[model samples]
Target: MWRELAAIGRETSTGGYRRYAWTAADTDCRSWFRDQAGARGLSHETDRNGNQWAWLGDPAAGDAVVTGSHLDSVPDGGAFDGPLGVVSAFAALDELRSRGAEFTRPLGIVNFGDEEGARFGLACVGSRLTSGQLTREKAYALTDADGITLPGAMEAAGHDPGAIGPDPGRLARIGAFVELHVEQGRALDLSGDRVGIASAIWPHGRWRFDFRGEANHAGTTRLADRRDPMPAYAETVLAARRAAELAGAVATFGKIAVEPNGVNAIPSLVRAWLDSRAADRATLDTVVAEIERAARDRARSDGVDLSVVRESFTPVVEFGHALRDELNRLLGGRVPVLATGAGHDAGILSAAVPTAMLFVRNPTGVSHSPAEFAAEDDCAAGVLALADVLEGLACR
Candidate 1:
């Protein structure tokens, strides 16, 4: 399964995946998913919001046990971040079939679209749309860097733009949803465990900071006479690091753009996106507030106009205790429970469904990069663990 998916959307220069939403790369991934479902002889369908589902039994049968994750990737993302869960899902089903598990309920595997939000800047778009956390109007308003709207991209990719909206009936049929993923951090590695359960997702958000100033020739403009926004933007980046450290949170200026992006020209506008997260809502709020305040102070001193817009925000998500406890029992109660700073489709769906997650150990504790990895043994363990959970949840 990994071999088949490894080549799709991979950038030769970076050895990282670029499976962004509604692009050719993503289309290839969707095709791969369909092929996988067909190979397994599962009834397959694409939901209104573009999420794919493969069912082993009638989906109309309520209380279906569903497991899987997205197949999309961030810019130059690691192979395991999203695909691990999906591959593990199929592998788990094979394991269950080998064990001759008698199903008492329907089983499903899903590939939720646009979980990375690399192009549209909104994570978990498919799941969010299905859960009604994102309105069709707002989703239609989402535009990519190339000035293409989300609906336009969907249409170009041969998906219907008008069919997207909340699908409560589909969600209501799901009794439980479990997503297995590669550990984004070293929690399982540090604990000497191959698999762990997710406790909660930290409150996280993305904010856009724009600093406006006069553009001029970099070589000719005097340092004292020129009003450059780059310096202010740089200071804000440092300020964010300091604030996050002080508040025991995490913040990063991961993406940015500059008007007149040239080595010989001073930027007229420096726009950067801040991704911030904390264990709790109060700490997250405080960290972001301090960072914004520092940016404002620096912008005033640098004579640059500053504006901040919160592009997206997700509150902390605590997995339901009943489902989590059931998974613990299914896994022999030895797996460690850990919290994460990362957001996910499971986190988005937890609002409307009983959702949980499993994390495979990552030795390097790296993610969203080519260097991110998991051992073969750890992946095998993850697949077996998922198989056990599914057997307990859906089998007699």
Candidate 2:
């Protein structure tokens, strides 16, 4: 499964994949999913919000157990972040079929679109929209880096933008959701285990900062004569790190856009994105407030205009206790409990339906980059673990 998807989107020289949402490559993946479902004789359908689902039995039947994850990637993201859960679902089905496991309930493998929010700047957009967490109008108004409206992109991609909205009918059919993913850090590795159970996802959010100043020729503008917002923006970036460190939060200024984008011109507008996560709501708020205060002070001193807008915010989520405990029991209580700094579509679905996550050990203890990795044995272990859970949930 890794090799199958690795061959799709562009691969960086660093060995990472760049499968942005709603692009040709993502479309290719959706097609690939149809092929996979066709080969398995599982009927598939695309939801109003672009999520794809392949069902083993009648979807109108009683609530079904759902598994799988997104196929999209962050720019040059690691191989396993979103794809692991998806591939493991396929593998688990293969495992179940080979063993002739009896099934009394319907099962589903779902592929959610844009889980990373790498393009739309809204994480879990598909799940959020499907569950009514975000309004259709608000989703349509979202803009990409190139200023393409999300609705326009949907239309260009052969989808009805007007059809994008909450899907309570679909949500109601899901009995539970299980997402298997590569651990973003070393929690499982430290325990000498192949898998871990996610206890919760820390409260997280994305904020955009727009700083405006006078644009001037870099060579002609003197430091004392110019009011450049770049310095203030840079200072705010550094301040985010300092504040996160002090508050024990995770903050990153990973995306930015500078107007004129040239070495010989002073940027009149600087837009930067801040991704932050913390243990609780208060800590997260305090850290973001500190970062904003720093940016405001810097902008004041530099005589520049600064504005901050929160693109999205997800509250800290604890996986449904019953399902989590069941997974722990199924794994023989060897799985470690860990809270993730990263967000997942499972976190979003947790609010609407019971959701849980299984994390395979990553040796590099890194993610969102080329350095992320998992041992083959660990991946196989994750597949086996998922199959065990599926047997209990979907099999007679």
Candidate 3:
């Protein structure tokens, strides 16, 4: 499975995946998912929100046990972040069948769309839409860097934008949803464990800062006489680092755009996006406020007009105790439980459904980059653990 998926959306230079939403690479990944479902003899279907589902039993049957994850990637992302869960899902099903497990309830595997939000800037769009966290009107207004609206992209990718909205009926049918993913951090590795359960997701958000200033010739403009947004933007980046250090949080300005980008010209605008996260809501809020205040102060001193807009936010998600306890029992009460700063589709669906996540050990704790990886034995352990959970949940 990995061999076939490794080639799709991969960049030759970086050896990373670029499977952005609704793009050709994303299309290829979707096709690969459909083919996998067919090979498994599972009933394949696409939900109104473009989430792919493969069912071993009747979907209309209530109290279905579903397990799977997304197949998209961040910009130049590593191989295991999303695809590991999906491949593990299929492998788990195979393991269950080999064990002669008999399902008393319906079983399902899903491949959620636009999970990374590399194109639309909103993570978990597929699950959020189905759970009614994101409104259709707002989703329609999402535009990419190329000035293409989300609706246009959906239409071009052969999905109906008008059909997208809250999918209460579908979500209501699911009794439990479990997503198995490669760990984004080193919790499992540090503990000498191959698999662990997620307890909570940190409060996280993305904010955009727009700094407007005058455009001039870089060589001719005197430093003391000019209003440059770059200086303020640079200072804000440093401030983010300092504030995060003080607050015990994490913040990064990973993406940016400059107006009239040229080496010989002073940029008129500096648009940067900040991604910040903390273990709790209050800490995250305080950290972001401090960063914004620093940016404003620097902008004023530099004579630059500044505006900040929050693009997306997800509050801390505490997985339900009942299901988590059940999983612990199913896994023999030995697996470690850890909290994560990263967000997942499981986090988005936990509000509407009984959702939980399992993390596979990552040796280096690196993610969202080409260097992200998991040991082969650890991956095998993950598949076996998922198979055991599904058997415990559905077979009995």
Candidate 4:
């Protein structure tokens, strides 16, 4: 599965992947999924929100114990973030099936679509839509960087846009969900373990700050007369860092756009996004409010117009307690339980169904970049652990 997926997507010059959802690369990945499932005689179907599911037994026989993850990638994202969970899921199922393990209940794997939202700017779009967290209208109206609507993209890709919406009936088939993912940080590395269990996800969100100023030529504009928004944008970045540091949180101004981007022009507008996470809702709200206030103050001082809009917010998610306890006892590793600042489809699905996650140790503790890595031994161990968990859940 690894080799097959690696061959379809664009590996950037920097060594990361560019497998945006609904694109040709993602289409090829889906085809690969269908072929793999077909070869195993597993029934495969796509949900209303584009999530793909492959069932080992009858899907309608009973609520299935589902395991899997997203196949899409952030632009230039690490190879393992989404695909590792998916590949591990397939491997675990293969192990169980080969061993003559019988699952009385349905056992299934899923490949959720648009989890990264690299093109549409809405992370976990597939999961969110499936769980009714995002409305169909909002999802269909989402636009890419080039102003292409999501519906337009779906139509062009041969999918009916009208079919996109919340799917309670489809979601009802998931009795439980377990996702085995590559750890995005050094939690497991610090503990010297091959795998860990996720306890919760920190409250996190994305906010856009737009700053506007007068446009003038670099050669003609005097420093005293110019009201460039760049300085305010810089101040906003600094404010984010300060807020996060002071509040014991995390914030990043990762995406930015400067309008009239001519090297010689002191331009009109600066749009920057703040990705922030905190341990609690109150703390996160406070940190964001402070950052916004700071940005506003700096904008006023620079005579720049500023507006802040929240694009999305995922509140703190606690994994289903019973599921976590069962896995802890069933796997019997005394695996470390961790809280992640990063979001996942598992986290999104936790809203509707019981969801748990197993994270394979990432040696580099870096993600969303090319440097993120997990040793083969650790990956193999993760597959074994996931197989154990899935077998227990599906057979019990």
Candidate 5:
């Protein structure tokens, strides 16, 4: 399975990956999924939001048991983050079939679109829309780095943006959702476990900062006469770092671009994206407010106009405890309960369904980069854990 993922990774040269939703790479990945599902004799369908679901039984069955994850990756992202769950889901299904475990309730495997928000600036787009967590109009208005509106992208991808909305009819069919993902942090490594169950996801949000200033020739323009926004941008980056440290949260200025980005030109504008997260809503709010204040102050001192726009916000999510207990029981206490700071489709689905997650240990305790890893043994362990959970949920 890792070989298949690695093969896909070899096709991209961008630092991690650039498989934004609806992009060529993403489309290719979707095709790969379709072929895989078809080979397994699973019936597949694409929902209005572009999410793909493959079923092992009757699709009309209400409250079907579902599992799977996204295929998109962050730029130059590691091979495991989203695809691991998906590959493991397939592996588990194969294992179940090999064991001849007859399942009465319907079983589904899904691949949610734009879960990384790498293209449209909104994570979990498909799941959020399907679960009524986000409105379609707002989703349509979202734009990519190149200013392509989400609606246009959707249409180009052969999905009607007008058709995107809460998919109650589709959602009603899912009784529970269980996602198996690679641990994005050091929790499992610190705890000495190969597999763990997720207890919650930290509150998180993304914000975009636009700083406007005068664009001028870098070589001819005197530094004092330039109203370049770069200074303010730099200050904002430092301020975000300081603010996050003070608030005991995480704030990152990972994406930035300068208009007229020429070595011989002073940028007219600077755009930066911030991803912030914390244990609770209050801390998240405080961190965001402080970052905004710092940006405003920096902009004023630097004489650059500024504006902030919220891209997405997801509050801390607590998974169903009853489900967690059941999973633990099924796993025989071998798998530990863990909390994640990363965002997930499961977090959005939790609003409308009983959602849970199982995380496989990353020996390196790192994620979102090419360095991320999960041992083969741990991968198989995760599959076993997922199968156990699915069996219990399906039986119940």
Candidate 6:
């Protein structure tokens, strides 16, 4: 499994992996999934929104037990974030077969697209659309850093953008969703546990800031006369930090681009993106509002035009209590229940169906980069936990 993931990693130039949706790397990973599912004799189909589902039984079976996750990765993202869930789902099936476990209800392994939103600027694109959590028009208009609209990219990738929308009928087939993901934070490590059940996902959202000013020669432009955007941009970043700190949440100004970026040119515009998250909706809203106010104030004082647009917003999600209890019971012990700040396909799907998550320990307590890790033993433990849960759920 590591070898397969490493192959995908090798195809990327940004350190770890960059399998953005509809990109060559993502397409290759999709093919890899098809090959794996075929080898297992599972019938496979791609939904209208491009989600891939491989089934072990009849498709018409109502409420099929489903497990899996996304395959796309952030730029230079670690090997485990998305792929571990997929690899573990396949491995769990193998483990079940080895143990001769039988099921009454159908079982499905799915590969949700664009969970990272690295290309389209909207996370959980497949799951959210399929679950009716996101609208078609909003999704189609989303653009990447290169300014290519999502619809154009979808067309380029041979998927009809017009087909994207709420898929309640398709989602009705899933009785429950259980996603296995590498723990992206220190919670599991602090608890000293190999496996955990997710209780909730912290509220989170993304915003884009565009600051416009006059471009001028760096050497000739007098400091007093210059209407440079960099100062306003810098103030906005600082405001974000201060606001997040005051609100007791987290905020990041990670992506920035300066127009006329030449060393000898004063930038005419500065564009930055902010990712903000908090334990509750109120805090998240407060932090975002504060940052936006600060940005506008700075822009006005600096004679720079400003625009702030919300890219995506996912409220704090509480996993199905019944499903979580079942998973805990299957483990035969008090599996710690934890909440994550990270957004996931499971979080999006929870709006449509009973959804839960199992997190494998990340020794590094890190994700979205090459340094993320899960031990071989921990990986195997995750499969066992998944198998146990699947057996219990499928038998119901």
lDDT, each prediction = 0.95, 0.90, 0.95, 0.90, 0.87, 0.89
Tell me which of candidates 1 and 5 scores higher on lDDT.
1
Model 4 steric clash pairs: none
* Winner on lDDT (2 vs 6): 2
**lDDT (tens digit, per residue) of candidate 5 on 1-396:** 556656664435554666778877887888888987999999999998899999999868787999999999887788888999999999988888777788889999999999998777788998998988889778877888789998898888777788888998888888889999999988888888989999999999999999999999989988778888998989889988998899889999999988899988999989999999999999999988998998899889878999999988998999999877878998887677888899999999898888899999998887878778888998998998888888777754
How high is the lDDT of residue 121 in model 6?
78
Candidate 1 lDDT score at position 351? 93
lDDT of 3 at 274: 99
Q: Name the regions of candidate 4 deviating beyond 4 angstroms.
A: none
Q: lDDT by residue for model 4 over 147-210, one digit each (tens)?
A: 9998888778778778787888877888899999999999899899999999999989999999
Candidate 4 versus the native: TM-score?
0.98
- In TM-score terms, candidate 2 sits at 0.98
| Alpha carbon deviation, residue 292, candidate 2 (Å) | 0.7
What ranking of all candidate models by lDDT puts the best one first? Answer: 1, 3, 2, 4, 6, 5
Q: Model 3 over residues 284-316: C-alpha lDDT tens digits?
A: 999999999999999999899999999999999
Off by over 4 Å in 6: 9-14
Lowest-sum lDDT 10-residue window in model 5:
9-18
**What TM-score against the true fold does each predicted structure earn?**
0.99, 0.98, 0.99, 0.98, 0.95, 0.97
At residue 17, what lDDT does model 4 achieve? 81
lDDT of 3: 0.95
Off by over 4 Å in 2: none
Clashes of 4: 0
